[model samples]
Target: MTSLVDLLHHPLRWRITQLLIGRSLTTRELAELLPDVATTTLYRQVGVLVKAGVLMVSDEHQVRGAVERTYTLNAQAGDADNAEVDHDKLRTMFTVFVAGIGGHLDQYLTRATIDPLADGISFRQTALNLSDEEFTEFITAYGELLARYADKPDTADRTRRMLSTLIVPD
Candidate 1:
C-alpha cells in the first residue's frame, strides 16, 4: 500500500494513471497525449509506476527502430477503500495533473497549423443521479467494460484516442 501511495503521490504518475484508466498506451503515445512533458521524463515516471506494481508493461513492439513498451494500469494496486491516502496530497496531485493536460492542449491549439475552430473536437460534461444500489451497479459495469478492452493492441487504423472520465458525486 505504501508503494501504491507513493506511485499516486507523484503528479506525473497520477496523470499517467488517469490517462490509462480505461486504456493502455506506449510511452511514445503517452508523450503525444501529454505534449508538455518530455518523453524521457514520462518514461522515467512510467518506470516508477511499473516498479511499484501500479502499472505493467502489457505489450512491446519495435517502432522506428526503437523498442516501445505499452503499459496498462494495475487494477489491484489502486483501492477506492484505502484510508491511508492523504486527501490534501491527492488534491494537489490532481491539480497538477489537470493543469498539465490543459497546458498541453492550449499550446497545441495555439501553435498547430490545424484550426480547432474548423475541427470538430470538443469537450463536454454531464451529470446524473442514481440510488445507492444503482450507483454500485453502474460502477461495477463500468469497471467490467474498462477491463474488457484494457489489453487490446494499439492500432494505427483505429480512430479512437485516450479520453479522461471523472465521476464525482454532488
Candidate 2:
C-alpha cells in the first residue's frame, strides 16, 4: 500500500494511472492524450511505474523507427483495504484527477473537429440503495464484465461508447 501511495504521490504519475486504469496505451498515445506533459517525462514516469510493478508492458511493437510499448495497471500491487491511510484524501485526489481529465477532453473537443454534443458525450450522477451483500455482488459482477472484455481489440473504443458508473452509499 505504501508503494501504491508512493507511486501515486506524483500528480503526473497519478494522471497516468487514471488514464490507463482500464485501458492499455503506448507511450506515444499517452503523450497525445496528455498534451500538457512532455513525451520524455511521461515515458520516464511510465518506466518507473513499470519497474515498480504497478504497471506491466501489455504490448510491444516496432512502429516507424522506434518501439512502442503499451502498458496496463497491475491489480496485485496494492491492498484495497489499507487501514492507516486517509480514505478521504485518496478519494479527493481521484475526484480531482477525473475532473481534470474531463475538463481537458471537453476543451479538446470544443477546439478540435469533433462535436461532443452531437456525439452524445455526457456525464451523469445517480443515487442507489443496496444491501452490503447486494453491493458486493454488483461489484463482483462488474469486475467479471470488465475482465471479459479486458483483452478485446475494440475494448478501448467500447469504453468511449458512453458509460460511467459510480456507486455511493446513501
Candidate models: Cα lDDT each? 0.74, 0.74
lDDT digits (tens) for residues 1-79 of candidate 2: 2456656767788778877766788888899988999878988999888888889988888889888888989888665
State residue 57's C-alpha deviation in candidate 2, in Å. Answer: 2.0
> Which lDDT tens digits does candidate 1 get at residues 74-158?
8887565366548775665566657756745764678548666655456788787899999999989988998787557657965
TM-score of 1: 0.57
- Angstrom error of the Cα, residue 39, model 2: value is 2.5
Residue 165 CA error for candidate 1 (Å)? Answer: 2.0
Backbone collision count in every prediction? 0, 0
**Where's the lowest-lDDT run of ten residues in candidate 1?**
157-166
lDDT of 1 at 32: 89
How well does each candidate superpose onto the true structure, as a TM-score? 0.57, 0.66
